[model samples]
Structures are given as structure tokens and as C-alpha cells.
Target chain A: MSEARLNTPISPFPSREQKQEERAARRAAVLRAAVRMFNARGFHATSLEDVATSLGISKPTIYHYLGNKDQVLLECVTIGLQQLLEAGAAARAGPGTGADRLQSFLRRYAEINMDDFGRCVIRTGEEALTPESVRRFRDLKREIDTAMRELIEEGVADGSIAPVDPRLLAFALAGALNWPARWHDPAGPQSPGELADLLVATLATGFLPR
Target chain B: MSEARLNTPISPFPSREQKQEERAARRAAVLRAAVRMFNARGFHATSLEDVATSLGISKPTIYHYLGNKDQVLLECVTIGLQQLLEAGAAARAGPGTGADRLQSFLRRYAEINMDDFGRCVIRTGEEALTPESVRRFRDLKREIDTAMRELIEEGVADGSIAPVDPRLLAFALAGALNWPARWHDPAGPQSPGELADLLVATLATGFLPR
Candidate 1:
């Protein structure tokens, strides 16, 4: 929740120094390929060989960097969640009425087009992981959910948001944020920002709010 | 959406007598196994052999009954969707107003706690289907969406619901309906009818339309 802690580095923040940047890019490329195949074909359906082939890299390199296929997946999901949480935390920390903070955070998330819509490892799907891995992802997921819920509750208390069940509101907001992975098209009529705005307005203003 | 049209046997629904009833039971058993597997392990992660093994049948028997893996999946999804749509339709036919119909339909879906929790094939990790499968599913998907949206639109027009973009309302209603797949638990605090009522009330009342 603290500003400095919120912006703290997530696995070194995918560097900008040339050598490090190239390495980060390759790592990202691997993660990207993994997500496409994992999401489209499924994580179990995909193999280390498949990921290596897609990346034009040796399978050994992947093992060296991320340990195994599961680790690679965990990293990808964690990275994505960390990004959202960071944005959400920063937004909440901003100087504004609760609505402004909530909107600011959600808009950034909405702009995340559907192409990268991997299921968050912290959500229930992490049951796909090994027992040890499950503990970690579950902890992270609950933390994120709790933090996000607190932010919304704050907005409600400040009178920016109308009275709504915080829990249901969480689900609704999470549902909208999570839906893009299921339906977003890069070539679609509305851009991510436009879609996010529409969602924000709809949730904030009840369709038939008295 | 004619009753006769839906009643037409689609392979699994072979006969009208006890023979057909037997077939339907067999089909439901197979679908139950498939759902359990798909939920525990994702679709691409699951193998036909695994499902066959779970059913205590040989691979050949599964193939004989359902043709191939894709067809089995198609049937499983069809079964789940048909059950959901039929429940919605029945509510529509028995309701007081369009809003009432929508609320009843929503409540019916909330019955995830009764026993059908996470059994809805349309929600949760469905992206891995082959393109051909996606097409067939989309057709059915469209009909359900249109039917639900029409109900919402009617509610708005009748002053029973607030006037909002029917399209967005459709999406939000969808978000609400599909949410149970993620969180509903029969062993949890809420009953199926209670959860459904809460959801319908939340959605119907808007922020405060109640």
C-alpha cells in the first residue's frame, strides 16, 4: 500500500540497458509464446519443446532461466498480476476522491487488450500448479483481491461510488476486467481504452440507478 | 427456439422410449466425467483416454458412443448449455414481467450451489476448442445471448428496468450469470436459490432502482 513499496521492482522490471534489455526481450518472447500456446492449446497440451521451438531457442535455455514449464507459467501470471496490482495500488494512493482513484486504476487495466489475457495464477486456476506452487499463488491472489476490495470499499465510504455490495461489486469489476481475455480482438471497432471507459461507466453508474 | 426443434434427437437423444432414456443417462454420465476432468484439468490438458478411463470404459467404447474427442466435447457443452438455456426459457414463460423474467432467469442460474456449480460449460477456460468447435458453439451462444438481451431490453422498455445500452446490459448480465462457475460452492454459505435471488436482486435493482 505504501507508494515506494507499490512501485518496487518486479523481477528487475525487464531492463532497458541494451544487453539486459535483449535478454529481457527474449525472456518476454518466451513468455509470450508460452501464453499463446498455453491459452490456445492449454498449458498441459504445450511442452517445453513447443515453447523452445516457438522461441527459436534451445530448451536448455528455458530450464536455465525459469526452471521448468510450470515456473515459466507462474512467472508470466505473476508478472501480469504484479503489473495490475502496482497500477491499482498507485491509483488508490493518488490524491483524488475515491471514484477518481478507482477509475484511474480500472482504466489502465481496461486498456490491457485481450491478446495478453492469461488467467491470473492467483485466481482459482492455480490449482493447476504443484502443491507448493499452489500455496504461493493462492497467497498472492488473496492478497491482491483483498487489497483491491479495500480500495473499492474506500471509494464507497467516500460517497463517490453508490451503495453496492462490495463483494458483488468486486466480482462485477473483476468480471469486466477478466472478460477481455475471452472476447477482445485487436482489430475490433473499439480500442482497449474505449472499452474500459464503457465498462467503468456501466459499473459506476447502475444501468437503472434510482 | 421452438420446442419441437430442441426436442429433435441429436445423436445422444436417440430414442423416445426407455431405450432413449437409457441413452440420455449414458450421455449424462459421460458428460459428468468430462466436466469433472475439464474442470480439474483443462480441456487441452485432458485426454480422451483419461475420460474413457474415468468412465470405466475402453477408448473404443467412448469413440463408438461419441465419435471423437471433439464430438464428445461438443456434446458435453451442448448438454450444459441446453440445461441452462431451458431453465432460462422456462422462467421467461412463467414470469410476471420482463424484469421478473430476467430476475427469475438469473436466479435459476444462481443454482450453482444446488449441485451444478462449475458445471456450466460456457464459462471457465473454454478457449482451447478447435476452430470448427468454436463456430458451432458460437451459433448456440448467439441464440442464448439474444434471448437474454431481449428480455433485458423488454424490461427497460416497460419501465421495470432502467434504460441502458441493451448491448452492455447483455454483457453485464452475462458477467453476472457466468460468475457462479468461478465461485459457487454447494457446501458454502448460500443455497442455490438464495444466491440466485441475491444476484438477480443486485442486477435488477441496479445501484438503487429497488
Candidate 2:
């Protein structure tokens, strides 16, 4: 009404950037809640309603943010796989011999498997996802496997690693690290970092004497 | 009333031992069918009807033989664990150093994991079972873990295996071997024995150069 009020230029609505940020935050929160429940309970046992109830939101709100339970699980596992892929890439780009880079990637891989999204990736089976999601999940997992094999091949070429079958060696190392997802107790004495180091060390030297 | 009839040895009905044997055979067949389905489709997604239909029987027949789905799963995993336990005992009793015994046990362990009931054990999550079933499952699994730890301890004491934490080492080895249940294909190029050998060889020496 007044010239001063018109010149103030303050709006009651949130700006576009603020609205986008809020939406992203809400989506992440819903995903976090869903993944934790899925991890604690089996995927079939956990309901989207339970996730929504934990977050003080409605079931429709979850659907709006994440589409459905299957989509939520797919997203969680994808994020975990992406983190592993990024870690492999980073390790490849970074340091010493092939052995050193492989170890670095392995340590990060183990640590990620112990976290929320990472645990979901390990705990989830192919039968839990839809056909399309399972295909995507397998594709992403294969890429990670290929990256590990490449690292091992490089190490072998440089004589930093032993002349072993890279494929089998990768499976052994990944299995040793991934098992922590099933057995590692977050409340136990060893932290994720500590457990990862011990596992990687065991895989490096093995049971046989040097 | 005839003398020949009175002296006849043949009977129309089966003997008690024969009946018992038949019953046992039928029960085993049902269990095999159920475990295969559970492993392929997952515990939650698999139905008793599907298992029965595959075997050309009805659902009640499955219930009659295995009690319920939970009981069937528990039986499957329990059989797998018992096989592992028996292998451990056999290895302990066999001739050789602790390391030799441990390797013998580990090979059998990997082979059993690729079998029907053993694959079921690896695929079924604790959450898939009822509370009581889960408790029993955990107890059986704990016994296996103890057996593995004892093998590692004996090997360490005899200087056959390197000095490492028996608990962590056992976890690493068991994890590496147990993973074949998820990835090993029965129709693949390698036989279970060949694959087991490869996996154990990888673990015995590890990735690092000797």
C-alpha cells in the first residue's frame, strides 16, 4: 500500500533454490529411514508404513519422495555401489604401486560395506529387487568387480602382487570384506576402520607363513 | 486253512523297517525340493505349494513332512551346519598337522556350500526364520565358528599357520569359502571340487607375493 513497503522487496514464499534444497533434504531423510529399517529387518519384513512412521510422515509422502519401497531399496544399493566405484577410481588415480592402490580401495570398500547404504547393498539379494532393478544392480556390481580385477592385474604386472588369478582373488578379497556387513557389530569394541584394517591384513598375508 | 497257505512266508504289507525307510526317503525328497526352491527364489518369496507342485504333490504333503515353512528352512540350514560340523570332526581326526586338517575341512566346507541344503543355509537370512528358529540357527552357527577358531588356534600353536588372531582369521576364511554359495553355478565349467580348490588356494597364499 505504501511506497516504503513496496520498496522493501521481501517475499513470504521460499526462493526457488531454497525449495529445491528442501526437497532434496526431505528425499534423503526418507531414504535414510527406509534403508535403516531394511537393514535391521529383512527387506520383506520392513514396510514403507513403518519407515514413514519412524520419520513422522505419511505413507504417501514416502511414495511422493521415493516412488515405492522397491525404488527406495534400488536407490540405496545404487548409492552404495557408486561410492565403491568412486573409491576405486580415486585409489587408481592416487598413489604408490598397484598393491598400495588396491589396498586403499579395499579399505574404503570394507568401510562402506559397514555403513547404512553399503550394508543394504551387501544384505540385499537379487531376488529382493524387480527384474529391471536386479539387472541394473548386477551391472553396477560387475563394473566394480572389473575395476578390482584391473587393479590386481596391474599389481601382478608390476610384481607388487603375486601371480594369482585376478578374478578368484577379487572374489576372495571382496567376500572377506563383505562378510563384515553381516557380522560386524557397530556397538562392538572394534570400529569399522579397525575391523577393515584387520580383514585386509589377513587377506594380504593369508594364513600360510611367509 | 490249506497247508501251503499256512506255511507261506510272503506278506501283503511292508515290514516296519521298509515302511520307515520309505518314510525317510520321502521326507528327504521333500526337503531337497523345498531347499532348492528356497535357494532359487529366496525364503520369503518361495511357497510350500510351489515346492509341492514341483514334486507332483500337494501343499499338505509338504506340511506333513516338514511341519511348516519355518521348520523346513530351519531343517535345511541345520542339515547344512551339521555337514560342516561333521567335516570339521573328520578333519580333526585325520592324520597330519593342524594346517593340513584345517585345509581339509575348508575344502569340504566350500564344497558343501555349493550343494542344495548348504546353498539354502547361505541364502536364508536370520530374519527369514521365526524367533525360536533364529535362536537355534545362531547356536548352530556359533558351534561352527568355534570349530573354525579351534582349528586356527591349533595351527598357530603348531607353527603351521602364521600368528594371527584366530577369531579374525576364522572370519576371513569362512567368509571367503561361504561366498561360493552365492556365486558358484553348478552348470559352470568348473566342478565344485575344482572351484573349492581354487578358492582355498587363493586363501592359503593370499594376494601378496611370497
Candidate 3:
């Protein structure tokens, strides 16, 4: 066989699954850059060109992978919410107690908010999205809120957490977790894990002396 | 003297101080409406025309009173921060321990986030602002953050609050307090004051059983 033909068989031409994996990885890279830019600059001020430029990818390549700015934002939020939902499920399924589960979930929640994808979820406003996108985003957000409230309720029922209004308590905790996305700097003195651990500890056990 | 001349002395065509008060009140009214709309529809989607229409005033009137859209947003944030600063000062000077002072300040902070001016401050991103305006806003926000940390430090020193990292604690508390601005609805089931009180209580005392 010719040298080129021999090399083709040697590389095996990358199976379809491998090709798909490569495509997914590229898409993920684009998303990471988009989220970082959107977090630094407001969604309204950021453009697809800026995201593409940051990644050294062409605008068409971005469109080919991410669709558009709105789509990119939607994907970012979707990924973040999915991660949160998964963490919630894990915490619920595997835990020492209700309070333990809630704290574990909350630590993950706070840590996520400090990441690029999580920050994008918090930073993207509904106004920037289409009505349908907004509705979907709201639904996902509601799911997360519900999961949090359910954890608190479980804790309360188990006598591990106080009988506080679950809805309000969830909002308070969620706010605290989400707020870091707006201000957390990766280059800051404290790492995301340290901040998350401190915050979760404060909530799980009151900051006031026992 | 004629009847008109005698009545003129009674009315006095409005004193300069009265006129000034009226102008100030009108300007405030314009700001109130603008902030509400900005908070509801976002600063970018909202137009002076929309605000003017909502307030039954002309666009030029909004311009005459509040300058451009950026100016209106800046003023809203400025007013909100000033109110917060004033509350911090009061809490610091008021009687009780550091915990009490911090709670008092946090209550006001949460309440402020629920109001139009306060919501505007939280909702407005600095990406839409000029460099000078962003600088001013950051300075003001930094002042508020410093005040919160100071209050927390005082509480720790006085043995009112637990020995925790004041910076992290402040971030956690501030995040919870500021979260209301993003979710609290005026027409919602609970009043802003009630919600603020409940949230502040949760953070101050925490939700775990004593």
C-alpha cells in the first residue's frame, strides 16, 4: 500500500464516536469562553464575535457549534442548572442526615456559582432571551428552587433543621450562593472551594456561638 | 386695592423655597417611576419614552430632570447607596451589641433592595456605564461592603457574633440580603418589610434548632 493509505489505516480515521467527542469538546471550549466573557461583560454588551475572537475561532465556527449568543447563553444556563440538579439528587440519595444532605448540596451549589458556567447562569438576564427561552430558563430555575426547598423541608421533618418557612429559607440560601457569581474573582485570595466551605458551614451551623 | 391685588398677597405666587421644594419633589417622582420601570424591564430595554409615558410626563421632562438614561441609572444607584450608607451609620451609632447593629443594618439593606431605587442599584450592571460612573459606583459599593465587614468584625470582637472570617460572613449575609432585589415582587404575598425581617432573622439566628 502507498504510504498515505498505510497511515490512514494506522490512525483508523478516528471512529464516528471519537469524531463526535472531538466536536463536543470544541463546543465545550467555545461555551467556556463565552461564559467567561458574559460574566466579565454583561450579556447585552458581549457579542458572538467577541467570544469567537477570544477563542481564536471564526464567527462561522461559533455559529456552527453554538448557534447564536442567546443559544450559547441558554446552553450555559442549562448546563449549570443540570449540574445543580444532579448535585441535589446525589445529596438527597446519599447522605448521613437531612441537614448533612442539605449542607453538602449547598456547598456544591455555592461552588458552582463561582465557576464560569454557573456565573453565566446567574449573569444572563431574562430580557436577553426570547420568551420561549425565558420560560425554559424560569422552569429550570424553579426546579432548582424546588429541589432546595425540598431539602430544607426534609431536614425540618427529620428534626435536623429548624421549622422555618422552607420557601423563604431556600431563597435566602440560594441568594447567598448565587451572589458570589456576581463578585467572585478566580484570581482572588480565596479559592472557590474555601469560600463555598465557609459559607456552607456558616449556614449549616449558625455563625453565632452555640 | 383691587380684590385681585389683595388676593395676590394672600397666595404670593408661591415662594422660592416652595418652588424649589416642588421642583425637587417632581424630580424625585420622575426618578421613582424611572427606577421602577428600569427594574421591571431592565435599563437597556427601557426607554425614556416608556418612563415618561408611564409617568404622564414628556420625554424632555425626564431629560430636563434626570439627564440621559445612564444618568437616570447612576442617580438611582447613588440614591440607593446613600440610603444604605445612612442606614449603616445609624446601625453603628445605635445601641446594642455588634450582632444587633449588624442585623439592624442588614434589615435596612434587605428592605432597600426591595424598593425601586434599591432594586435599580442591584439590577444595573456597570458594563452599561462610563468609566467614571463605574468608578463612582464601585467606590460606593466598596464603602457599603467595608461597612458590613466592619460591623461583622465589631460583633466578633464584642463576642456577639461567632469567630468567623468577617469578609466571608459579610459576603454570605450581603448575598442573602441582596437576593431579594432579584426576586421579591411588590404584589407578592409578603410585604418587603416582612420578608426582610424574616430573612434577617434567619441569618442572625440561623435556622438550626438551638
Candidate 4:
């Protein structure tokens, strides 16, 4: 034990918590770079080397940090969905009419889709993913869809929203919110927040039962 | 003179009009096959051979009819845009109110995007095209956007729509309508027409000045 202690340097390894935090931070940084490249050159066309070059890291480093291209994409999508789901939860918890909560949730949803990670999530299609990954992606997307529908139903029940088909309404709202990721210009005059506000307001103002 | 007459066949070949018709039909068939394949397995992953095999035609036949993959994609996008432009024209001509025209136009637009050709057009992005093709595609899409904005402005001016920013409203409407191409399932419960109607009603019912 004394020989082992003598051979080992003090603070040779980080604490477990510290290592976990560092790993997470590195993972996030790699994901950010990956998402950017994926958005610019579609998910299929983008290789790990492409991502590695952009971040000034080696291809194996990306694989080391994130398992593979699929895992990288899945991670980005999970982060994006988690953010939207959290926003939905917050909106539900906030004090407001159902309509107000729905609107706020939608606005955040739209803004997120145009953000760094979210844009990648929206742009990456099932064709790029493995069968299992596709299933997971679809399930998560469906969860979001169900949440939107339920929010709309709540609004209708409470007399804040019009009596519309919740499923169809959810589709329309989600479609509009998800679309900005495809065409939104980050350098354009409209910031993500401004564009999100404009879209959500249009839906809210036009959708209310008069 | 007798020898010349004997040498010439009784019915030498098809007339110019007949030949043109045949060529056009074959071209249409090739395009149809290409669009279907592109929609099924995105544009980049799809090859001329895949389209040809699906149609039981040869790759040379696809090239003979459509020139190349880039040409195939450009043609599909052109057809999609033309259909939308035609719908806009029809809406403009068949009028109860400006809002009525806009709603009708939007419904048709959504349905077109869900159709085989239009779905391919939506799924094909700029990354897959040459710079010139991308420019042309963007120009046509911009034309559609402008038409939508004008329709909304007319509705607002005529007191059929609420006083909203027409450009923003147009984007919201177009985003909602264009998105169905990405996720719409033909095997699903909702028919394209039914889905379009529900979406249009949601927007129109909510947007009218109260």
C-alpha cells in the first residue's frame, strides 16, 4: 500500500462528480458543433469527419465523446425535446388561463426549433436514423403532440379556446412552430424570439373564440 | 420513280404531334416515378437506378426522359410550385371574400404538399441542388410567399381578416400548411382533404375580425 501510494501522484485523477461534470460539458460542446454542421449540410450528408473538422477535433474524439453519428443526433434530439417538454411543464404550472399557457408553450416551442440544437432536431429525419432510433424519435415527437392536444383541450374545456378538433389544432400549431427551423435565417432582421412571438400571436389572436 | 416509291414505307413514322405527345407522356411517367422514390427515401439517398428499377425502366431511360437527377428534382419542384400558383389563381378567381380566397388557397396548398410530387418537392432541399437550381427554386418559393402575403393583405384590407401583419401572418399560414409534407402519413386516419379542411377552418374561424 505504501509502495502503491508512493508510485501514485496526489490528485492524479479528478473526483467522480468532477469527471462527470467535465464529461457532460465536453459532450455538450461536441453536440453544439455537430448540430451546427448537421443543420448547414443535412444530416445524411454530414459525416463525423465533417463535424470533427468544424470543431478542430479528430473524428475519433467525436466517437469517444458521443458513441456514433446516430447517437450524436439522438442526443441532440433528446436535448431539444427535453427543452420543449420542460417549457410545456412550466407553462402548465404558471398561473394563467389554458389558452395563455398554451400560447406561451407554443411560442417557446417555436423559438426552440430555431435554436442551435433544436434546428438540428427538426431537420434530422427518420431516414438518417436506425430503426430503433426512429421509433424512439417518433415516440418522443408523439408525446409532444399529445401534450399540445391536451393543452388545447384544457383551453376548450375552460372556455378559453374555441371548440376545435384538438388533434388537428395541435398539428396545425406544431407545424407552424416547427417550420421556422427549415427556412429561418439567423442573420435576418427577425430574431428567433421576435419570429416566435409573431407566429404564436397569429395563432392565438386568430384562434380565440370570439 | 417506281424504285423510290418502293423504297419509301407506306406509313414512314409517327407524325410530329404524335411523337411529341408520346415523349411528353414518357417524360411525365419518369417524373412520377422519380418523385415517388424521392418522397419514399429522401432525394439524396435515391438514385436514378432506384427510380428506374421501381418503374421497371432502365437508368438510360430515366436519363433519356429526365436528363439527370438534378433535372428530375428541378422538374418536380417546378410542378409543385406551378400547382400552388394555379391554386392561388383559382382562389383569386373564385371569391366570396378575401378571407374566403385565402382559406381556399391555403387548403389546396396543404393538400398539394401532401401529394406525391409536392411531397418530393418539399423534401428536396437546396443542399442537393446546384447553385443555379437553388436560385431558381428559391425564386419560385418566394413567388408563392409573395402571393400568400398579398392574399392576406387583401383580406385584412377588405375587413375580412383581422388587422395583422400580413407578411408574418402569411409565414405562419404557409409554415402550418407546408409542414404536413414532412410528417403526413397516407395510411393514417386523416385524409389529406380532411386534414386540410380542419387546418383551414382553425385559421379562418379564428382570424376573422370579431
TM-score of chain B of each: 0.80, 0.95, 0.94, 0.90
lDDT tens digits, residues B1-210, model 3? Answer: 898887665575788999999999999998988888888788889999999998888999988988998898899899999999999999999999999899899999999999888888888888878788999999999999999999999999999999998988898998998889999989999999899999988887676777
After superposing candidate 4, which stretches have Cα over 4 Å from the reference?
Answer: A1-13, A207-210, B1-12, B207-210
Against the true structure, what is each candidate's TM-score?
0.78, 0.96, 0.95, 0.90
Residue B197 Cα positional deviation in candidate 4, in Å, after optimal superposition: 2.1
Kindly report the interface RMSD of candidate 1, rounded to 1 decimal. Answer: 3.4
**Consecutive 10-residue window with the lowest summed lDDT within model 3 chain A:** A4-13
Question: In candidate 1, what are the lDDT values of residues A1-210, reduced to their tens digit?
Answer: 799887877654554686687877777888887777776666666798988988788999988767798788788777766777777778878988777877787777656524363343323264467778767766766666676677778877988766767776666566656666566666788787777787666666555436
Selected candidate, larger TM-score, 1 vs 4: 4
Q: Rank the candidates by TM-score, best first.
A: 2, 3, 4, 1
After the best TM-score superposition of candidate 3, give how far the Cα of residue B82 lies from its true spot, in angstroms. 0.6
**Model 3 lDDT tens row, A1-210:** 898887664566788889999999999999989888888888988999989888888999999998988898899889998998888888889757788889989999999999888888887777778888999999989988998999999989999898899999999999999999988889999899998998888876666777
Q: Considering lDDT, where higher is better, how would the candidates rank from best to worst?
A: 2, 3, 4, 1
- Cα lDDT of model 1 by residue, B40-120, tens digit: 676656888999889899888777667777787777777666766787678778847777787777676556423432354
Steric overlap count per candidate: 0, 0, 0, 1
Candidate 1 chain B, run of 10 with poorest lDDT: B111-120
Candidate order by decreasing DockQ: 2, 3, 4, 1
Instruction: Compare the candidates by DockQ and give the number of the best one.
Output: 2
CA lDDT of A185 in candidate 1?
68
What's the CA error at residue A52 for candidate 2, in Å?
Answer: 0.5
Candidate 2 clash pair list? none
**lDDT of all the models against the reference?**
0.68, 0.91, 0.88, 0.85
* Greater-DockQ candidate between 3 and 4: 3
Q: What is the C-alpha RMSD of each candidate to the true structure, in Å?
A: 10.6, 2.0, 1.9, 4.2
Error of 2 at A192 (Å): 0.8
Give me the candidate number with maximum TM-score: 2
